[model samples]
Target: MPSPARAAAFAAAARTILAVTLAVLLAMAGGALAADAPAGKAGPEKAANASAAGSGDDEDEDDDEDEDEDEDDEDDYEGMPPGDGRDEVFAYCSACHSMKLVTQQGLTRADWAEVLVYMVEEHEMAEIEPEDEKLVLDYLARFYGRDRRARKMGR
Candidate 1:
């Protein structure tokens, strides 16, 4: 059993704690709602929604036009062999020969080694990536290596 004075003090403490808690909770909820609303360049929730709904469609249409322009620049590379940076290496190296011609020749690493050296010496093949000669030789060797002698196509 509490004395009258003690009971009144306890009741006052509980009310103060509850009031502070309610104030903190309301402040948090107000902050959450404001953040969830779009912060437009206009600065108010209703104006942000109106600006987006009314004016943003044109921006999206412009994006579609830009994507179409990029597609206009890409050309298809035909039948390159499997290798890392094969396309870049091919793009630079195979202007003299079709990718098909390079892939068709059956050669050991030593065979392509001589070809690369010959191109570098007789016809300038430009300085390739130091590692690329080996990679290209390996690709050429594996696919075309099985048949060393050439055969003409179509009887």
Candidate 2:
């Protein structure tokens, strides 16, 4: 058998070789990932430049399209009526989810309260203050509760 010192030296050399190989592999993987990344967003700048170089026709059309898009963006919260709790609900809920999803639900006040609890416990929504929670619950119960849903169904 080899001497203990020689065996320890061989083991240390093997470990060093393995560590260097792993480092090189990780570096190569990082380079490949960087190389495969999507190209930067120079698309709109190019389009604008091209439009500038051309006649005014494309620029006018683009302006009209942008105006239409702006209007649609403004209507994103159209379903939620203006009310006391509207701002709170919008600020809290819409941070993560679309307001449309909130407007579609129709639950009783108690159910709405439970939903808030669920949001906190299950989905880790921020805890609303007790006073704010009451306001939000009242608003939901008034506008999106079962009675509103029933009325919509002509009940």
Candidate 3:
């Protein structure tokens, strides 16, 4: 039987070995996941821009057709109702996330204001200019407000 001090030392060494093994396993798993991930997947902003700019390919004729298609797609706002501040809302919100995420919400004006504030404060979103903020709020309230259900039902 080992002395208590030797036993404690063995236990400590075993813990160290276990920790190192876990760390190595975690690292290998992470690397494997990264390797398996699709090459076409990208961050939100990059994906949006890539979709807009078309696939970067060597075919020159296809590139010209893509450019024309991109021009037409520029005005497409992904189902956000057309309104006075549609451009501002699209430019700001779509920079970080899909416009579908924005259009699906049916919050009141105050709730929308709170969400914008939360996004800026917690998510490090760029602060909207005061004039643009007002326009965005108004546009959201008009088209996507809580009353949207009633309006849609009536329509």
Q: For this target, which candidate reaches the highest lDDT against the unseen true structure?
A: 3
Worst 10 residues of 2 by lDDT: 38-47
Q: What is the TM-score of each candidate against the true structure?
A: 0.40, 0.51, 0.50
What does candidate 2 score on TM?
Answer: 0.51
State the lDDT of candidate 2 residue by residue for 23-91, as single tens digits: 999999999978643221122234335436754555446677777754643353445664556556665
**Candidate 3 structure lDDT:** 0.76
lDDT of each: 0.58, 0.71, 0.76
Give the C-alpha miss distance for residue 80 in model 2, angstroms.
Answer: 0.8
Angstrom error of the Cα, residue 36, model 3: value is 25
**Tens-place lDDT digits, model 3, residues 2-118:** 999999999999999999999999999999979744222332344356556865665556677766755544436665654567667777787688787998888899999999999
Residue pairs clashing, model 1: 106-144
The TM-score-based order of candidates, best leading, equals 2, 3, 1
